[model samples]
Target chain A: MEIISFMIAPLAATLILGGILVYFGIHVIKREIVFIDIALAQIAALGGTLAIVLWPETINGGGHEEGHHLIEYLFSLLFTTLAAGLFSLLKSKKIRIPLEALIGISYAVATTAMVIILDKGAGSDVHIHDMLTGAILWVGWDKVLRLAGMVLIVALFHWVFRKNMMNLTDNYDNSSYKSKRKNWWDFLFYFTFGLVIVEAVQVGGILTVFAFLIIPASTTLLFFSTWRARILAGLLLTVILTIPALWVSWTWDLPASPVLILFLGIILIISGLVYQIKKKVT
Target chain B: MNTLLFLGPPIVISVLLSIILGYFGNHILSRGIIFIDIAVAQVAALGTMIGLLVGFGEESLGLEMTSYFFTIVVIGIFALTKFADQKVPQEAYIGIIYCLGLGLALLLAERISGGSNFISKTITGNILWTTWKDVWISLLLFSLIGAIHVFFQKRFQSISLNKSENSSINRTRLYDMLFYMTFGIVIVKAVPIGGIFLIFILLIAPAVSVTLFTNNWRKRLIGSWIIGSTGSVTGILLSYSLNISNGPAIVCLLGSLAVILTLWVILRKRTVSV
Candidate 1:
């Protein structure tokens, strides 16, 4: 009972976060901008680190002081919006470099910049470890409720723009170069994406957020084709995987985020194998 | 003068890393596998973690060999998955591999005492503490890798730049395996000295900046070396004066340089159009 009670918050957090992430993941995978989430997550992290640097009071031992989370969130969101603008702008055909290369460079530069900032300002090496590992297991009910509200708003936003969003991702290769409206839609998509990533990274850390975003979607894609089927199945898969992953992590005293990621990776590999075998059998 | 003497080895190592990584960065950019280095570096770090877990001393030859072995396996996986690019983009796989490696490393880090320190050190590196022995070893290893690249220059160029349809699938796979194998080896060696962040910047920023200006392969390579070396030297000096970590300092310098060059290119194009 105690363990179950303790696990409930994290499990709920995962499901809520996982729901939106998997949806975004499908679009991300479809558009083939697979690394964009990680890049944005790093940029958000850079923002959060800069906040800590500017206001050292935010660094109370390892975690931030109470009520300062909003400031940090806003800082990260501001940085992410700027990056979203840059990404949307850079989608020009004149640029010969692949978008993936630019994304990778963004990730590298953001990470290194964070390192420099952390070194100079707070001098907290522990913050780097914290950012990567996250505090999913220690998540409170307040945070979960807060996350739910944000996810709902974003989910509703996506639902309203479903036609534009779906069309953009579905026919990305065909329509992207033709439409000037594509960039506007891209900015909106990325801004919402940044919102989710900033929150997701806060809860699940970068790796878990990535695993939640990519692995479930990739796994579902191996078994399903349609977006409707893929998103529904991916969300279902994440929900199923989260419970066992949390249980295993709790029972064994393992780190929650990585164990969850490893579980996702295992499921993805199994799904790939099953897909291959089904192809052979049919 | 005293500062120069103290920072000499680090400066040399940084320049050396930039030269090789700059060359490989061109290949990476052309191949559209920019995140491959990060994936490879993460896997190598995981291998090192595993080696440590299995009781290999931190600086032991066995640990080094274990790291190399793990890197080779990832290189092989990447080579095999190259064909799957038709079905799924390679970037997805690279991203997956990176996450898996990082997650597993974190899981393992939880087991070791002071493991978080090790993890942070791998990311930030300890370039200031580098000895002359480290410099000589990297020089010898880098030169050996450089010689191999020079020897097989034509095959690599054909595969990476041209992606010629003339080459057989198996032959291309072999060349790719060979390419990533050398690339992985360089990353493994360089990660210890410059850390993953610095190493990534060293690999990318120079090649990216140079490619902004030139089309010729020789010009790109020479330009990359010049840009890389200058960034490295200036970065080291700045870090020394600022009393900051060398790797991030260098990364910031190179990163700014790349950004400046990119903005210049974009603005120049705009002006020309006007």
Candidate 2:
């Protein structure tokens, strides 16, 4: 049963995450800002790192101190929400510096600040290293359930209003260029985007989230033109990648993040080769 | 007096590195080849990890001699990223190469460490953990970087900046190869100080900070060096005293300085209007 639960843990996380990505990741790719997800994840990491670095201060009368649980989620949510909100608000069309640069800066500041902060404190600690890497062995039933609930809620909302979300990302200029209500729809995408980064960070750090956000979505956009196929492809790819990653990490004693990343890399390379072959043959 | 000496080396190194990287990086950034910086830094870092694993393992010399030797390997691999005129944007190639390089490094490190322990340092980079020996090594690296950058400074400017002059000039494919060689070296040397996380800022930020003030590439380079120099002096102290990460503090300082100057420019604009 313990082994079964352990196996199910990765399966559940992958399915839930893959389903959500299948629905939304395609559009994120279409926007040509796949790096934005990584940026948002880094921002979330920044927030979480800040909170973790400061949590000790709260105990010593620093009001900015946060609970361990809150530290993990709150800061990331704050940054992601604020950033996503701003991106939606501006309806940014072709920012000169890809949003990834902003995210990279966020990581630079957060990771360094975290080191300084952590160095000063001595205590009962959670090494955030594993969380960021998504060592599948680290995922438990609780994490799986929480992420599942979040994904379910997101997927449901996506179902009822898929048209609005698609319109906002696929043709933002058309939407905001002519209609105002569409701006509100963009808000929903940003909200979902922010929420995914926050929740994913608490569960699997940024790398896994970044890889799925870009690779699967881009892969779909490459082969499939319609929104529905792209979403299905993304969902399938995320699962296909995640399962093997978890198994390989366990069997080979490798880190899950790299395993997951390698799986994505393999998929990307294979897909690229196939795409090339098809182009040649046709 | 204490602070000046404390900050002197890193500040100098960062400024020098910034100027050298500026000529290559700015071109890449403008062309939207951002991930290339990350990809290159990561490949070099994996080389460093191999150096660390071998250096610390009974014999240290093997590590030092071999770590940078891997740059040749990365350059050879990265050269293929252009993929014989395949239309994939340079940034896409960068992302692919960076992920592949990092995956290779992570696999190697885990095999040696037997766990994912060193990964924290691998991904984020730990500067406070830097040794004086590394500082000395960085100084030598910067000197070498400085000599090369200044030597061909005009050529870089002419090729990347002066497009109209391209037809008239005869710098040749050798010039392109020289730039890539320097680009690989900058990434290799910048790894320890800037790590994968902050090199992009050091590469692009000071340059970005400088471009706001001047149109001339020389002036832009000088302005960026000044910003880097000032940030280096201040950031190291801030990192030491306030217990902050020096890299981000440097970046924040860079960003803050940019904001102040930007504010001044807006103020000047208003004054002129009135």
Best-fitting candidate, scored by TM-score:
1
Tens digit of per-residue lDDT, candidate 1, span A52-128? 76877766664656546667877898999999988776555555666666676788788878777766645466877
- Each model's C-alpha lDDT? 0.84, 0.63
Across residues A81-112, which tens digit of lDDT does each residue of candidate 2 receive? 77666555433332234444444454455555
CAPRI-style quality class for the chain A–B interface of candidate 1: medium
Per-candidate clashes, comma-separated: 0, 0
Model 1, residue A152: distance off in Å is 0.9
Please provide, for model 2 over B1-274, each residue's C-alpha lDDT reduced to its tens digit, 9 standing for 90 to 100.
9766666566556655565565555655444455667776677667767777654552355654465677666665555544343444444556556666666776776667533545554445545455566667766866686678679866666655645554422343455457666677767667665666556766666665555456666676667666666676677678778766676667666644543454455456556778
Q: Which residue pairs collide in model 1, if any?
A: none
Q: What TM-score applies to chain A of candidate 1?
A: 0.91
lDDT, model 1: 0.84
**Which DockQ-derived CAPRI band holds candidate 2?**
acceptable
State the lDDT of candidate 1 residue by residue for B163-245, as single tens digits. Answer: 55687889888988998999999999888788888888877788888887787889989998999999889988888888877
Model 2 lDDT, residue A61, Cα:
61
C-alpha DockQ of every model: 0.63, 0.29
In the order shown, what is each candidate's alpha-carbon RMSD?
2.5, 5.0
Q: Candidate 1 regions off by >4 Å?
A: A55-67, A120-123, A171-176, B267-274
